[model samples]
Target: MVSKTIQTASPYLEGVYQPVLEEITARDLTVMGEIPRDLNGLFAHNGANPRFPPGAGHSWFDGDGMVHGIELNDGDAIFRSRFIKTQGLAEDLKAGEATYVGSLAMPGQGKRHKNVANTDLVYHSGKFLALWWEGGTPHELTLPDLETRGTFDYQNTLTGGLTSHSKLDPRTGELFFISWAPKPPFLNIGVASEDGRITRFSEVPLPGPRVQHDMALSDRYIGVFDFPLMMDFKRPDQKALGFVLDDETPARIALVDRKDESAAIKWFDIKPCFMWHISSAWDEGYEFVLVGARLDGATRHTKSGAILDDLPLVDGEHRFDSHPYMWRLNTRTGAVTERQLDDSFVEFPRVNDHHICSGARYSYMARIDINQPTLEAQGIYKYDLATGSRTDLKLPMHHIASEMSFAPRDGAKREDDGYLIGFVTDKQRMTSEFWITPADSIEDGPVARIKLPQRVPPKFHGRWVDAEAFRTA
Candidate 1:
């Protein structure tokens, strides 16, 4: 019997989201500027790179995960790319086609696949873990070569799964994360020690199943969102994991103690809004300050009212307006106050690695162009949290970039004393460039630009693993 071929109307199937058929390893790449000698580490970017075309009703989130990395040592850079080699990808490869439907597929219409491990990459406990945002077992990968080691289950100690945006406290070497599924005790919060041991796990009950994408962590507290956006299994018109902007559901925030399980988990009510990423969070006096991108409503369809899976391309109608905002939660009075931080359109926020669970002076994020056809960013924006000022690191016309990864210099003193690195794809040339810019002078352009051999698809989250991460492994 002849096998059927899949086709897709989704815009992600083409352009930067287009999948690369083969992997390549290149050494001593062409660099346009002086690579900082002190910048010694590996920058690994993880994204979706489907092996096969996802036919109708496919979502961009369904593609297989791929890691594109470059290692820098003493001003020298080497490039290597590889598929995450997840169980789902392996099964599909063995079948000679895609056996499982995408995240937006109708329930019971396709086989359920293992974790795609495509959304983000984190380095903790001396291992690089590739994670999926929708909850799954994180896949471990070795550095320098980007080899897939295997799945990590906390020595089979975890009662729940993992989130893509797990937080690692730089000072304590402890990892904090949360997990959620469509079942009772819908959320599970946990922490892992420096050596990858599950030390604390707690089942946080919620009213119902909600789409909780990211979390915020301060020195002493972990913040999880119970936003208004949730899954509606009764929506027949929208079959795939039915997502609806629930106005009736009140948005709330949950704060749990990072180290003490006996401490009460406090829940505070907030205005209805949606946020998919958190820039940073910290404690101040008696309040917790959380910074992130907030949208008035979920952006899931186009102006034509067509779902993302049915859209041919991402146009302005498909673009959702988002802005940086700061939320302050009072621990004593259960009072919540929020204010818009900036007016610019931005997302994929990042701060220095050393400031993950602490307060930072500045944040670097991708700036989106309103006229662009796709969500690909047009430049980088540096926001000063102290003065509410902004600096723009604009890219050349027709050029797009990825989320900035902040790499601090050796013996760096100040928080902003670091370099920002990320991939920039030039549509005019159909090529990609790896850029490095001083965290304080992003507007001055890259201090170094290493040319990539192939175009990397626009991806989700990545990390900058210092040399010490591998040394201790």
Candidate 2:
């Protein structure tokens, strides 16, 4: 599928990060092992796959949003993939070319950039939404067939853009999310009921506009992070990049009551660092503790305000070491205490969906390879938060992996009783495979491996949707 000597202008357009040109649907995929009868759901993921050649100053982040889904039920599996028909991509399809400017393009004041809806994939209220971290209208994709349904606006009351990180509490069936923008009243927090009602949507004023990739939700509180990264708008002499990492400012977290609508939100300052994802958060007595894979500063841009070409690298290598750490804020004294949980550098931290609200003792994250150039993972790390020990499920070299999607077993009692599913691309072969392993046993490898019909490029986050969640679709 690829040659060792293949040459491309951009490293992103080569190997597993390269775009695929097919939309496919295949039934009865061949599996290496027996499919679990108790497993019934879809492991759906979204990615940025450019339909045509990217525009000038094209960062790896710029592309058409594509969703790949594999549905399992009654010991059978089906696979499907589709390009999310976002308004921008639809126009490009009609014109038979790439029309929009790249992500690093300079736009004048009050101008807007294109929304690819390419960063994350989520399921809520029987609908699968393709989301972009840049804060834009979410595009909806249907199940079973993987078809585009158009943009979803939270029953039409959603006024501003929605980010990719919307935390859903499985216990109460309510989704807690925040949206950030570059304009005044920069941040807005929203809570939606199980049936998709926007119950409480209010503006949370900030000192200025910032970039927040993800948020955390606990049983009693919602955590909205404020890092040193901020949007640098266009100027006459300078080209406008999306964001810049400012070391002069401090990082803070705004904690809001999970259920109380009238409670005041408080901001607690922490060390100046940035985290693209949060692991798990909970309330431990008088402390509100949150764990994440932390970096010294934002790695997406350099000190000179130029956007980095590689989304998962710094200076074509592992520029920063990210470790899983926990931060505890004293609710009464307003003091912050933090510590490193492990020594390994990893990211894309996730817990069981049920644990996202109540917190869990275990967390599954992607192990970032120190010598890698792309966002490829060398393995998956299962961290025991209770004992501060780590177990690894390492992958073969040249296998670029995605985030582990935890699929709970039917009527399961334990948290890690289900399967950990993910898609990995063989960078050397340019082909893809779907892997499923027991969540409880980290060292044991995949129980089942299915070769995908299409090559899948390395991309961002995804979640496991239960079989019952797609009854309406």
lDDT of each: 0.81, 0.78
Summarize candidate 2's per-residue lDDT along 1-473 as a digit string, tens digits: 11112124767777677788888988878788888889998888887888887665466777788888889888888888888888888787897777776655555322136799988877776678888888787788877666888898888867777788788877777777788877877888887777866778788778887777899877888889778677555433664455567767788998888777788887899997888888889889878889999987565554455554444563232234688999998878999999888888888888888888686888999998766766666789999888887888878777778788788988988989998888977878888888888998969888888888898887788878888878544
Residue pairs with backbone overlap in model 2: none
lDDT of 1 by residue, 26-63 (tens): 88789998999888889999988888766334567768
The most accurate candidate by TM-score is 1
Worst 10 residues of 2 by lDDT: 1-10
Error of 2 at 97 (Å): 0.9
Tell me how far the alpha carbon of residue 74 in candidate 1 is from the true structure, in angstroms, after superposition: 0.7
**Model 1, residue pairs in steric clash:** 7-55
Q: What TM-score against the true fold does each predicted structure earn? A: 0.94, 0.92
Name the runs in model 2 displaced over 4 angstroms.
Answer: 1-8, 108-112, 233-242, 300-320, 471-473
